[model samples]
Target: MGKLRVKVDLALCQGHAVCMQEAPEVFRVNETDGHYPKVEVILEFPPEDLREKVMDAVRYCPNRTISVEEIPD
Candidate 1:
């Protein structure tokens, strides 16, 4: 699998958990101080097979805070 980088914008994320729903293996949400939970990446460099799932999270993020970039060799 090719290398990849993933990031989530905490300021923009609403903890909707759509990313987690799309790729639970790569994303999760953490409740913070009783406020809306925050999104987290469980796997920054997911396997090749899970690439699509990661992309799905990026696409499905309600706030468009999720981003995944390919790392060139």
Candidate 2:
């Protein structure tokens, strides 16, 4: 199995939770910490094609804070 990863630039996040909204299994916000705080998350790399989904999240992000990188299988 391979590992899929998502990177976020907190500086540009702008508290947007689109990634979390689109893929809850892969993204989250830690409300306990503060408004729109990223909590422990995972990138659903199988089934629905996570790379594309994460990319969409990155592209749709008004702040452009999300990115998806593929790992060797």
Clash numbers, per candidate: 0, 2
> How would you encode candidate 1's per-residue C-alpha lDDT over 14-71 as one tens digit per residue?
8999999899999999989978899988898887889888888898898999988888
- Report the number of the highest-TM-score candidate: 1
Q: Against the true structure, what is each candidate's TM-score? A: 0.91, 0.63
> Residue 21 in candidate 2 has what lDDT?
71
Which residue runs of candidate 1 sit more than 4 Å off their true CA positions?
Answer: none
Candidate 1 clashing pairs?
none
Model 1 weakest lDDT span, ten residues long = 1-10
- Looking at model 1, residue 60 earns an lDDT score of 82
lDDT at position 11, candidate 2: 62
